[model samples]
Target: GKVPILLPPLPEQKKIAQILSTWDQAITATERLLENSQQRKKGLMQLLLTGKKRLPGFEGEWETRKLKELCAIKTGKKDVNEGNPDGKYPFFTCASEPTGSDEYSYDCEALLIAGNGIIGKTHYFKGKFEAYQRTYILSDFSNAVSVSYLHQFILYWLMRDIDREKQHGAMPYIKLGLLQRFNVFVPSIEEQQRIAMVLSYADQEIDGLEFKLNLLKQEKKALMQQLLTGKRRVNVETEAA
Candidate 1:
């Protein structure tokens, strides 16, 4: 059986199409801007996090330190099943977004690293939260390094570390020893904070663009619903007879 399709009058259809085209163009432009903003942030991360591009009036030698020296690392005792949607605390699993849990495990600013699935994926949170058994928590950061800075550094370097592990014939996953031995280049605390702040500003811009893109898409969808159905009529101008 063939399905019947309802179409508007030729002029009205053309007008609707034209209106939708405008929205399409806007969506495409916003998508391009979002991509460019993300690329800009990635470039900034590569330069600033590596110390190759120093911010104004900050000049000093960067020291290298092992992960163990910078913070205490441990795995969470809770499992994925422990997460509760209505719980009080954020329950972190290997996934990107945290679920909820009533119980509190750790209370500090730390980096949550996915140990297995989505390996090397990291989340930075500065409050009380629970974690999955496979989630590695790095807390009690040394005064020499800012936890925010370390979070940014790990995000920049973690992928490379994973690739290196693959090159060494090991499975792609975060091990306790890997965290203990990973090397981080340390700049002064003040410089670290400055770099993190700049990168964060870049993040905020990207987020705002994303929110705009979503809104544009949603608006376009609503327009399509109205125009395609008989719910809303289009005004198509006619030529003089």
Candidate 2:
């Protein structure tokens, strides 16, 4: 069987190719930026968690602590309907985003761990926030060996352990008891704050770049759709006969 190949005129084809090439370049640049961010974050985690890299204003030997030894974990109250209109508290759920409640649940700074479904996801919350049943809220900062240090340590440790224990099934589950047994390496409070600040700054930059890249891609897509459909023609035109 013979296959027929249809080709556009040279000029039109070149214009199409040039537009696609621009998209390719944008995609490649975005991918490189994403890869760089991931690599940098991984490197920072390795160094900061292990005490290989020391931040400014901190000098202390890192310590090991069981997760349960440092913080008190509280299951979130399942009271979404109790949200008060004049309340000023942020409501949290198993997912990272805030819920539609203004009532405060936990009254202090703490780390929130997802208790079911996509388990082991952690978020640091300050002041007060209402938490749902699927989340475990950590409290008792004074009792913690070092609150800031423990927070970072637990985050890294939780992610590692959860990835390891996740079963090959439809859903991943991390039992609260199992999670509390996870081990962690902790530095002094000062070191913890320093490491968190540095990594957080990097994360902010990466997020900003991602937002800009998304906007650019959206603009490029709109341009391509308009130009290809002839709704928004470019300045170039076909030569008259």
Candidate 3:
């Protein structure tokens, strides 16, 4: 048996190859930008969350406290199966996007953590939201710890816990007791606000880059459809322009 191949004329095939290669290079460049931005975010988390880095407007050492001391933790009342697709409120089942909810269990600035499936994932949101019974909700933040700062701290350290869990090869789960005992470093409320602001800006920048990447991908997809089908032919001399 012989391998299959496209039978376009040599010149036309070469033109198509060159055009596709250009698109591939563009996509690869945007992908690299996305990866770099994500890495920068992780680096920022290490420095800012640990109090190793500080914003210019504020200065002070961070306090050490258990996770429970910063906020209260409780599991949701509804099970994952209880979520309704057409409900009005946001209903979180696990780590991914939330379903719709007719009612909400809490309405505040809170952190949502997965307790079972795809565990250790976390979400922070303001206003009303519903959660699965296995979803751990951390709300009623303490005055000593800024909620956003605390969210960052958890986001930073949760990676370590995830890595450790991978070593065990056991099902991922977040025990309420374990979270209650987990400790974190906390700066003054004002300093926390500044750190959160900086990180928020970083996230926005990364998000903007992602949007551009998506547009580039869409453009390439449309271009391929036109070029491959010969609906929009590319002139070899156009490359010079």
Candidate 4:
């Protein structure tokens, strides 16, 4: 148990509580919207990536193929120290921020899939980049499947697997062979591009909503700092001259 805390006088307490309540309500609403948008994106990925829902004008059965048949896979060459802080290329690692590097092992559209820590997380990138040894870089997709479509579909598949079976042991790890042998249902190039385009637009909407949520949170933080410290006052309507 803990000791009870002191409180401000009645009027000031009521005013502060009222003002903070409005902000709390706003934050809750924004969070709900964000949750709904995220769920919608997941639903879209499940449908589009699995070929359960086809875009208009799309006909013919989707071909099922292993990942190795579609793209080339490889691990990175550069060590941790080899990465540069102020370099032109992206050096991906298991960490949150991608390291920078002057040199690159691959220079084309690729998916950087975390093979060790934060395993199954994937990043889609086009252009020159470097990767950590444990990270798997997949590129050079075939004409049957667009790179963008494959990237999204693979990520969706990984998400499903990771969600069901969380970790392998103490650390989650993905093997190159597992990634290579992964099976996927792919539509024609035209249909794949169409699905990718729709998902991309959906991503844009989610991004916009998330940005708004962040702004609201920042605003609320600033307000709490100002109000609680008595730096700013809540100017409630009053019967005064």
Best by lDDT: 1
What TM-score does each of the candidates earn? Answer: 0.90, 0.76, 0.85, 0.86
Clashes of each: 0, 0, 0, 0
Candidate 4 TM-score versus the reference? 0.86
Off by over 4 Å in 1: 163-171, 238-241
TM accuracy, model 1? 0.90
What is the C-alpha lDDT profile of model 2 across 91-127, one tens digit per residue? Answer: 7666555555666656788888777745777777788
Alpha-carbon shift of residue 83 in model 4 (angstroms): 4.0
lDDT of 3 by residue, 1-241 (tens): 5966544567776788788888789889989988998899989988888767777776766678898888888999997777789998899778577788889988988888888876777888898889899988999888888788777777778757766877898546777888898888877788888888888888898998899889888988987787777777767656520
TM-score, ranked from best to worst? 1, 4, 3, 2
CA lDDT of each prediction against the hidden true structure: 0.89, 0.70, 0.81, 0.81
Model 2: weakest 10-residue lDDT segment is: 232-241
Residue pairs clashing in model 3 are: none
The order of the candidates by lDDT, greatest first, is 1, 3, 4, 2
Q: What is the lDDT for 176 in model 2? A: 77
Tens-digit lDDT string for candidate 4 (1-241): 5966445556766787777778789889988888898889889998888878878888788889999999888888777788898989899987666879998888888888887767777888888898988888888778888887887887788767765666454336776767778898878888889998988888888888889888888988887777677776655557111
lDDT of 3: 0.81
Q: How many clashing pairs in candidate 4?
A: 0
